[model samples]
Target: MDKNTTDTPTEYYDVLIIGAGISGIAAAHHLQEQCPDKSFAILEAKESFGGTWLTHKYPGVRSDSDLHTFGYRFKPWTGAPIATGDEILAYMKSVIDDDGLQPHIRYQHTVESASWSSEENLWTITARRSDTGQSLRFKTHFLWMCQGYYQHAEGYTPQWQSMSSFKGQIIHPQTWPEDLETAGKKIVVIGSGATAATLIPALAGKCAHVTMLQRSPTWFTTGRNANAMAEELRLLDIDESWVHEITRRKVLRDQALFVQRTKEEPEKVKSDLLAVLREHLGNDFDIDTHFTPRYRPWQQRVAFIPEGDLFKAVREGLASVVTDEIDSFTTHGIQLKSGKHLDADIIVTATGFNLSVLGDISFTIDGEPLNFGDTITYRGMMFTGLPNMVWVFGYFRASWTLRSDMVGDFVCKLLKHMDANNARKVTTELRPEDEGMTLGPWIHPEDFNPGYLARGMHLLPKQGNKREWQHTHDYWLDKDDFPAIDLNDPIFSYAR
Candidate 1:
C-alpha cells in the first residue's frame, strides 16, 4: 500500500501513469472505470495535482482554449468558457476528489529514466524524489506518459545579445515569482504568443505601462467569455452532463468549420480577424502595422483575447505594441532592430515553451540507449519498437483533453484485451505494406508551425505518410476511426 521508500525493493503495478495533469487524471479515471482489477500509480513531479495549471502562476493566467472541450468528457464545465488557473485547479480537484484518486498519486517523484526488458516484458522506471533526493524504482507492464509536452522547470528565454547588460529583472511567465513587485512599474513583454497576449492585459492597469514587443505580429481571435449554447441548455433545466455534451459538440462543429475555412478561404478568415482587431483598436491605431501577422489564421495558435481585453488596454493607452526584432539588450531595456529602443523597469519573456521529449526521461531497451527519432509514431499515441506504452500527445487545433480522453479509452481497452488473451507484451511496427512509405517530421510544418514545436521537432518521433502512422489530430475523423481500430491488425505484434 505504501509508495516507494528508502530505495526499497521495486514496487510493481499493472500501469504507471507519468503525470497527474489533465490527461493523466483522465487516464487514471478510465483505468478505474474499465480495468478496476489493475494496480496503478500516478507519479507527479509537482507537490500537488494539476500539471499545467499548477506550474503556471502568472497574473490573468487562464485557459486559452474553452473549458467545455478542455475539461474531461465525463465532467461538466458550467463556468465561463475561458477559466482562470485557480478555477481550472478547482475543476481538477473536484474530479480527483470525486474519483478518490489522491491515494494513487505520488507527488515529487521525478522520473529520471526508464529501461525496457524484453525477456521480462516489463519497464523498470527510476525516479528521483524532489523532497528527499531519494531514488526510487518501479516495474510496470504499461507506461502512460501524460507528463505534457513542454519543459515545466524553466520557460524558454531566448539568448538575446548583451542580456547581461540589462539592469532590470527578466521574468518568464512559467515561473512567475509571487513576491516580485509589479505595481507602477514600466514593463516590456516580448513575443505575441498566448502567454504574452494573456499577460499584457493582466499587468496593464496595475503597472505604470506595458509594451508588447514582438519580432512579428501574430493572428488573434477575440470574443465574449460566455458560451450561449451552454447557458441556453442550463435554462432548460437539463442534466448538467447532457448540457455539457451538447455544448461541447456545438463548439467542436464550429471549430471544424472555422478550421476548414482557414484552409479554403484564408483571405476571408484574415479579413475577419483584422476587422475584429480594428473594432477594438479603431481606425486611428495602425492596425496593419502592429496587428497583422505574416501567417494565415491557425498557422500558429490563435490566442483568445476574451472581450478584446488586451486590445482594450491598447485603446486605453495603458499598453502598446512594438513589432520589431531585438538587436540586443541595453542597460535600460531592449535595443530594437529598427534603430529604436524600448526602456522598461521589467522585461517578461512571454516567449513560449521548450518542448520535452518523453518527459526528458532517458530510455534504454535491454541496456542499450533508445532514440525516439529512430522510431515512427503509430497514430501519434504509440511508437514503433516501444511496447505497452501510450503517450497523450493531444490536438493542436482542438482541445488537448479530447485526444487524451480518446487515448485513455484506447489504452484501457488494450489492457483488457491483453488480459483476455493472456498476453504480456504488445508493440507496433510498420507492416510490409509500409515498406515504401515516406517518413517525415512529427508534424508537417506547413500545416502548423508554432515556435515551440518547430524547435523540438528533432527530439520527437518521426511520422509516416500513412494514416495510421501519424497523429491525425483530426478529432472529427479520429472520433469514429479510433473505436474501430483492429487490435489484431498486422501492424501489431503481440507476445505472451
Candidate 2:
C-alpha cells in the first residue's frame, strides 16, 4: 500500500506501529513470527530507522546499557556489550534487512493526531511528512505506540541565571551540531549525567581543556566492555546465538541482584561504587565534594563508564570537575557561589530530556478528546478506555528493549486470543477487586526520579496499587508476570 500525502485514504492494516525504533522493530518481528496473518506497517517520524541512536549525534554517544540485553533476543550481538551508536544502528539495519521489513517502514511520516472511532471500530491517524510539510492519513485496526517517552527535538536545559550574559556558544548534546568546532577550545559541560560523562571523555584531547560543571554529583559505575562469560563459552566452539542467550541471562541476573543490593544495603552499595571511583581518581582527589552523590544508588540511573574514561580524563588534566552552585553566567564563563570562575569558549548543556506523553500526539476516542492523564494504565503498556491500543513504554532500571521484547510477545498473544474470540474492540477495565485501589504517579519517585520524570509526572497516566495496573520497572518480576497474564481476566473488556 502506498502512503499518499494527498487526501486519499490509504490501505488499512490489522496493525500499525507508531515508530521504527527497537520496540517497533521487535513488534514487527513478533507479528510476523507469532501473528503471521496480521498485516502491519511502521510509520517513522525520523528520516532513518534508529530512534535515539539516529537522533543523538553527540561525540562518544553509546549505549547506556549493554547490547547483549539491549539488543533483540532473537538477534545475536557478536560485538562488545557497550556498543557505539553506529554499531547499534547497524545491528538494527541488519534486523530490518534480514527480516525483510524495509518496505513496511515509511520514514519521515510523523503522526500528529490519532482518533479511535467506536462506530467504525478503527483508528484514523493524521500524519505529516517531515520533509514535505504535507498531511497524510493512515487507518488501522490496532495502534502500537512505540515512539518512546522523551521529546527528541530538544533536550531539557535549565535556565541558569544570566544565561544570556555568556558570550560563548551554548549547545545541548541532544542536538549537537556537526560543524561546531571543538579543536583547541576551552569547553564547560553542565550536568553530570551519562551524556556529560560521555561527552567529557570524547572532547578531552580535542579541547584545550574541558570542565564538567555540576550542581550535584551523579552515580557512575566503571566496567570493561567485553563479557568474559560469553568469551569463554565461544572459546569452547559454542554457537554465537547460544553464547548471546547465556550471556544475556547471566548479565540480567547480575543486574537484578545489583538492584536488590542498592535497596537492601544502600550504604554498602555506595561504598562499593565509591571504591571504583577512587581507583580511577586516586584517594587524594576531592571525591566527597565532586564525585560523591547525595542520593542513594539506583534512585537515578548509574552511568557505566568504559574503563573509567571520564575520571581518567579528569586525573590526566584533560578535563576537570567543579562542584558549586551557578551564581550567574559571566561574559566569558560561569560565576560560582564559592567565588571561583572558569574560562570557557563553548558551553555544552548536557542536561537530561523532557518526557513526552504518547509522543505528544493529540488523541480522541469516539469523537471526544482523550486525556491520557485521566486514564489508568494496565501494566504500563495498555490503558483503560483506549481500545485496541498498546504503548511500548520500556523499563527504566533494565535495558529498555527487554520490556519491548516482552510486550511484543504479550501483544501477539493477545491479538491471537482476540482472533479466537472474534473480537474487534478490546480495552482494559478496573476489576471489581480493584475498586478501592490507590492510584499513584506513573513511577514512584522513590524508585526512580530523574529530572525529566520529575518534571513530567503529572502529564503521564496514573498507576494503580496492583501489579496489573502499574508500570513495573522491575524487569525480573515482569518476565514472569507478563507471560502469566490470562486472556480471559476480568480486567480485560472485549467486544465484537
CA lDDT, every prediction? 0.93, 0.92
Candidate 2: lDDT of 332? 94
Query: In candidate 1, which residue pairs clash?
Result: none
Q: What alpha-carbon RMSD in Å does predicted model 1 have with respect to the real structure?
A: 1.9
Residue pairs that clash (backbone atoms under 3 angstroms), model 2:
none
Compose the digit string of candidate 2's lDDT tens values, residues 1-496: 3344476666688999999998999999988889989999999999989999998999999999989999999999999999999999999999999999999998998999999999989999998988877788889999989999998899988898999999989999999999989988899999999999999999999989999999999999998889999999999999999999999999999999999999999999999999998888999999999988999989999899997899889999999999888888989998899999988899999988989999999999998999899899999999999999999998888999999999999999999998999999899999888988998999999889999999999998999998889988989889999999998998999989
Q: What local lDDT score does residue 424 receive in model 2, on the 0 to 100 scale?
A: 93
* Reference-based lDDT, residue 409, model 1: 93
Q: 397 in model 2: Cα distance from truth in Å?
A: 1.0
Ten residues in a row with the worst lDDT in model 2?
1-10
TM-score against truth, every candidate: 0.98, 0.98
Clashes of 1: 0
lDDT of 1 by residue, 1-496 (tens): 3333564789999999999999999999999988999999999999999999999999999998989999999999989999999999999999999999999999999999999999999999999889888889999999999999999999899999999999999999999999989888899999898889999999989999999999889999999999998888888898998999999999999999999999999999999999988888888899888989889998888889999999999999999999989999999999999999999999999999999989999999889998998999999999999989899999999999999999989998889888889889999989998997999999999999998999989999999998899998789989998999999898888999
Off by over 4 Å in 1: 1-7
* True-vs-predicted CA distance for residue 241, candidate 2, Å: 0.8
